[model samples]
Target: MNETIETLLNHRSIRKFTDKKLTDEQIHTIIKAAQQASTSSYMMAYTIIGITDPDKKAALAEVSGHPHVTQNGHLLIFCADLKRPVAQATSEQYEATRANLENSEHFLVAAIDAALAAQNAAIAAESMGLGMCYLGSIRNNLARTDEILELPKHVIPLFGMAIGTPDHQPELKPRLPISAVYAENEYPAYEEDVAAFDQELADYYESRSTNNRKDTWSEQMIRRFAKPMRMDVTELVQKKGFNKR
Candidate 1:
């Protein structure tokens, strides 16, 4: 594998971090890489909020239900931002309407753009020997987060990422076999492949150095699906003035 591929394959979420600070140059270079990620139609519908205030970090940690949110050397919240382009278009006498901004397709596009940029940032940080973890649990209280961040209309906080010097190097989590995820021309039946992966994951969980368990991937997923999660997200999104259509 090439250096980039090797960096991608060795990805791990680093929860524990040392007290090392990221230099301004390092932050600039990493964000530059994120800005270089592909965006649909070049809309670049994303905004990143770097949380530096102790009060804000503490509030975010409480909202995310993860104390580690405040422990990172740098915490960035990636937001799906349609406000900027829409406002600019309106200012330029373009037909920018609430309906256009609230379209489900636009919402999806913004979300995808934010995710792509965050992944690019993640890879860049990893390549630089910095440890990072994506904090999706920030969605646990989207409304509260919106309030805390004082997000304006047409903007949604998709996720947060915490980056720092690694104090703990975790083992890479196992993934499904390629056959289960990849398809040639036509999509093939993947249940058998998933069944095989369930066994492999079960073994990995049982033998892992930390948080060892006897659960399989399928079992965990089943438990996760048993109850609906984030039921208020749709309403919250609508309140943010997006996905109305």
Candidate 2:
């Protein structure tokens, strides 16, 4: 396999990191790579906030409930931002622009743009011999996170990434089989594949080097969906002037 494919396949979410930090040039390069990611209609509706201050990182860590959020050498919060475009609109176009920006479609577009950029940044960090973990838990308390970041209207933090030198190497987690994930003309039923993958994942979880546990993918999913999760997200997003439609 090619080097790029190998990098992609060997990906792991790194939680433990060393004290070694990323250089300014390295951060710039990684962000430049992120900017190169494709955006819908050339609208790069994303903003990356790099947290450097110890107090701010601590506040964000509290928001995410993850110590790694504060321990990482570099923390980047990726936000879906429509404020810039909205601000750029002419007085005559302000109403129409605000209406479009408030639509759920634009909200999805902004979210997708942020996700794509973040994946690019992840790839770049991995290729550069750095380890990174995505911090989606920031959304667990979106209101507090927004307050910590001092975000304005029309901008929402989607997720964060913690990047630094690796202090631990984790076993690669097994993913769902391609048959379950990929389909041709239409979406195909993959109950059998999912059942098989559940066993595979359970084995991996049991055999992993650290924090070994007996759990199946299906069981995990059940725990995840059995209760309504992050129920306040919709209300918070609407408060930010998104998904009004």
Candidate 3:
């Protein structure tokens, strides 16, 4: 396989990082790659906040419910930002209607933009032989995250990414067969395929180096779905001045 495809296929989340830190040039290159990602209608509705201060990182780690947040790496928070555009419009004496500002479409667009940019950065870091982990746990306390980051209205902290040199090597996790993911004219039957893949996942989990547990993907998913998760997200989005529609 080509280098790019190989990098993409060998991707694994890195939890432990070495003492080595990334240089300013490396961080700049990664952010540049992220900025090159395509945005919805070129709105570029995203902002990246890099955290380097130890105290701030520790606070964010506590708020995110992930101790790895304060690990030896560069930590960045990706925010879905509509406030930038609104501020620009206001500067130009352009008034945005309530529908234009608070519609689901705008919220979705900003979220998509932020996700795309973060993925681009992740791929770029991986390509450069750097270890990285995406931290969705940062949203565990969205209100606190906003307050800590001093986020203005119309900006939502989507996720965080930690990047550094690898201190641990993990086995590649198995994925479902193509039969379960790919379909032609109609949606192919996935029940049997999923059942088969569950066995493979259970074996992997039991054999993994860290946090080995006897469980299948389906079992974990069932436990996850047993209760509503992050239900406050709707209200949080509304508080950010979007999703009102």
TM-score of each: 0.96, 0.97, 0.94
Model 1: lDDT equals: 0.90
Candidate 1: where is the Cα deviation over 4 Å?
Answer: 91-96
CA RMSD per model (angstroms): 1.5, 1.0, 1.7
For candidate 2, lDDT tens digit of each residue in 1-245? 99888889999999999988899999999999999999999889999999999998999998889889988879999999998866877878887787878999999999999999999999999999999999999999998888899999999999999999999998887889998999999997899999999899888988888788999999999998999988888988999999899
User: Which residue pairs in model 2 clash with each other?
Assistant: none
Model 1 lDDT-worst window of ten = 88-97
The reply for model 2, stretches above 4 Å from the true place, is none
lDDT of 2: 0.92
The 10-residue segment of model 3 with minimum total lDDT is: 88-97
Candidate with top lDDT is 2
lDDT assessment of candidate 3: 0.88
Q: In model 1, what is the error at residue 100, expressed in angstroms? A: 2.4
lDDT of 3 by residue, 103-214 (tens): 9999899999999999999999999999899998888888878888988888989999999998988888798989999999999899999998999898888888888989
**Regarding lDDT, does 1 or 2 come out ahead?**
2
Cα deviation of 19, candidate 3, in Å:
1.8
**Model 1 TM-score, all chains together:** 0.96
